[model samples]
Target: MNPLLRLLVLALVLPAAACSTLSAQQRDRAIAIAAAARAPAVDCGQPDRCAEPSPLRALAGEAFAASAAAPDGAPHHYALLLDEGGDALLARVNLIRSATRRIDLQTYIFDTDDSARLVLDELLAAARRGVRVRLLIDQLSAIADLQILAALSGAHQNLELRIYNPTFNLAKPNYLHYAASVVCCFRRFNQRMHNKLLVVDEAVGIAGGRNYQDDYYDWDAQFKFRDRDVLVAGPEVRTMERNFAAYWDDRRSVPVERLNDVARRLLADGVPAMPPARPAHPRRVEALSQAASDPETVRTQLVARAMPVAAVEYLADLPDKHHGDSALEDGVGAAGLAGLLAGAQEEVLLQTPYLVLSDHALEIFRGLRGREAPPQVRVSTNSLAATDNPIVYALTYKYKRRHVRELGFDLFEYKPFPADPPVDPALGGWWPGQAPADAPDPEVARSELPGGSLGGSRGSAGEAQVAAKLRTETRPSLLRTSAPANRPLPVTGAGPRMGLHAKSMVIDRRIAVVGTHNFDPRSETYNTEAAVVIDDPAFARALAASIEGDIAPGNSWVVAPRAKPPVLSGLNYSVGKVLERSPILDLWPWRYATNYEFQPGPECPRPLPRRDPEFHRCYAPVGDFPEVSLGPKSILTRMLTAFGAGLVPIL
Candidate 1:
């Protein structure tokens, strides 16, 4: 054999040989770390305290809407909505540079994009600063980006990385699905660590929908998927700190040291040794000072914010109890949240990106509407026109008309953001107010009553409608004067303004819940999920108002329904009504895809092509969605199966 071939053979054989040899080493290392990181077992009796809080709560609150304030009256000041890629990256880098104590990160995907590299650079810097850095990522999601992980491993002794639920087949000619992964979907390769969180020094935290990816931060020129995240600094963050520790110490979360030489080499080459943190605003510290001041002042101003919930005594999902369970919760939180919605006496405003409600959810939504009828229940999500996930839209769209007519659940899809929103020229950036997290509200709202004005509502539509409505609206001059007539059309109506990626719902301004779960099938059935449901009336009202205000005409859009909604035939209307009533599809309609603009062109006047017709390549590659359908074959189904199977992970 050629020397290179000989080397390849050795490399192939080495993993298994090393695994056997390193078995004890890996176990000992994991055990040593686990032992040191063990959390104290404490009884949860006080409503405000728990035996332990997950480190994730730093970014996400221990209790929904819980204030970040600590007892010393030092307002727990944290930044939220770092929409700019540069700004977000700077925040993490600053935290790393500033850290004096510890660094903890947990993510579903800590990829190797510039953002991820930037984060890695910071993590290495923190480690060099003598900050203890612990990284926990899902075993499966990280496999594709193994080089980054390897890079981190090669250089940082102070840093300990763990892969949650690592696949056993890593080295062998193996074929067996880990039970956990199978239930959670392919991201898990069946299981997942779907949490997005970062806690530094147990003081500052970042959490929300944005993953550690380039697209997440608007670094890519291609269409950036709008998402949301919250930064926190408060006593509640300790809860998240604890969660990170818990997962970090879990025995099943294998130490990255266990990875084979090949994987390890890949990582080592992929990541360079730590670099010192560069200043976030090395030149412009003054601006950060101002942004930081706002959050700090706001926290202090809201003095009466509720304290943490009293601790409840319980085991933290003991493996023996509900071990390997498929559901996120046993239903207590779900039931409580539903009760909050059901108790709604008036209006209900929801902005969920993925709305796949189960029968139980539908019943809860229906009950809130007074069973088949009510004052009004409005929901804003991506139209097929706006949704990224067309299949999910297909599943959910089945219920649109029924929810509208029966429950009076009026549905509106986001229009695109306008070419211009009031820009902060000082920031040298267009705020674009609220763009779509795949859900853009119109620039203006039509009358609260449906057919109020085509003339009146031209600019009323938001970023979402701007793309499609420009061709149709009557006041071409107004739009032309205000923006190019070719600018995307604004949505019409008194309909609620939309948002990009806020999975929140407010019931008569009484309660709300926001978290990882979207209002769609992928969230409900496919992935492991978590959320915080807030019962505070004030918070709910504020949240609802904030959502509404963002999409409001001056900031967003409120458009009227089509003067003549493409009138459905009595038969189609009846079918829509029937489909809408179906529990499974009704709660999470899929029709939104019908509206997704498949073609990308200059803003235009007509509906986009139904299919790509030519399957235009995805302009922005989201690293390939992993293909899962590899096994089994019938001659006829083989090719079709292969093609379809390839898309399973992305879906």
Candidate 2:
């Protein structure tokens, strides 16, 4: 059977399977239990009205107040979290452990993983200490973990949990049920809350792309993500707290106890015993403990270390962003970010796992390219080999070359682990920010390129022109080897492949935007997102340095014209070229592939190279297909994904 036809058949069949399954006894039992477990309403008023002085005020608050009161004080102070995964967890745990008044956390995915459990333990501990803990998680991913959530909410009178936009079908809240829900009610299920924020004591907050999950914090043995976040303090935190309050108060956010009787009954059963979380590295834990114990000293140290920012603003999408309301009126969605991007003067640095430029965004880029002094725009995103979402990759892959030649932006695709050696700590460490010593100088493109002349044709014509322009232009070569010039580099031992999951942008060394907003259609149209824009040259430069490190030759691959190989070489770069041109495959969202070598059921998986012990050389080139990690999806999931390929724009 044709592969395409098979995928279509699978998509249709899986939904039918979901409908046919009749766990009659289980469903009836669930209904009965839910009916009996109805929770009484508790009057938890507005978050702001409930606010109290942070205990830190008596301890750490003086230091922050002093910093803010200084005659030369900037509006905000920021610290960039360079630790790939561990440090982010440390920051959150420390904040929770030290909070005096309240803690508000809003996120898209709060998985029941080792890292998540550790954080949950801290929240529980904080609640025990009388700190108010409010957690708002998107229901899309949290539905399966209802029992755990119920237990958490029930364990502490000071803690409250809510799930956003929950589905009506509560018997089995797995992906199959969600898929069925989507099938039955596409519009509602299609929209999600994609916000990631953590604010403590209404004073300090952490925001970025990191979620509370194993993969997010580098606890997953199978995968790791190179991501970024910002530790922020000052008046801006109050604004972030209010944003959380708004979401918490939104009609879409339903308290977990209110998620129907069955869910409540399930919660009444108590959370199952989870395996002990892997202990955090001793140094990380020690740091967190010290910070938590001496909030004043830590605040002083943080203020001393923080980069002073001229201005800062928090932005968020409406909890009802799926309604497609104009962001300008509500100060949500991507309006603020879009406006910030449109004002770039010197350069724009974008780091996102996914890149699907909206029409407005494309126009912004086009205008920048058309400028007399066009800003040097550089974008670092996951290569086919490094992405976790092939469906989104398919959409962005089709526009890769056009973004390069037409938009005149330098594009770098992140390489999986072992492709690059261990990064130097001074340069950003494993998550390096300094460009490779041998990376093509950004100044070269800035100097040689004439104003609007570098721009190519738009759309398909623009894509066709890329090849010809690449052959003719004397511009700095965008195609370069992925390996770093430094040899026998320091290694972090062997582990799973590393992928880019950071969603950030630094513009003109004056503004930095970091949050859960991916530069994709889903973020722009279907889901709610949040980000903080700091208008500090120092902060922007710090972020840009990290971004620059990511785009360095050692960390990413430059997708350029394939080079001719020796006659004996049996390479197949042609496959990539063909895939780039094949409109049919591009049209079929689910018909995506990767180039990474897959060793299914291997007798012995490959080991790390002796010289490069930082990453295992687990994969080899597999033709020209682009590689992506979708985690451990079952047959039904694969089918749903394949079938839903055409829905990439909305998904």
* TM-score of each model, paired residue for residue: 0.58, 0.68
Predicted candidate 2 versus true structure: per-residue lDDT over 444-502, tens digit per residue? 32123211111111111111111111001011111111222111111122334456889
lDDT (0 to 1) per candidate: 0.44, 0.57
The residue-by-residue lDDT of candidate 1 on 1-651, one tens digit each, is 366865565566545444534355544553444334322332233432221222322333333334434453433332343333334544565555555667888776665545566667667655654567788876555634443444455455567777776665241112222332333233435445566677776766666666665445543222233454445555546666776676677665776656553243432344333344353322222332233234342232121232332221111121111225434454432234455566677777877655556666677766766644464576766543233443444334444444545555555454434322211212112122222332211222223312132112222333422232211221221102233222222333211122255556666666555545554434434444444444556555655754564343233222221222344445445554554444333322212212222224454323222133332221211111111111231121223222332232333
Model 1 residue-pair collision total = 90
Span of ten consecutive residues with least summed lDDT in model 1: 621-630
Model 2 earns a TM-score of: 0.68
**Residue 639 shift from truth in candidate 1, angstroms:** 19
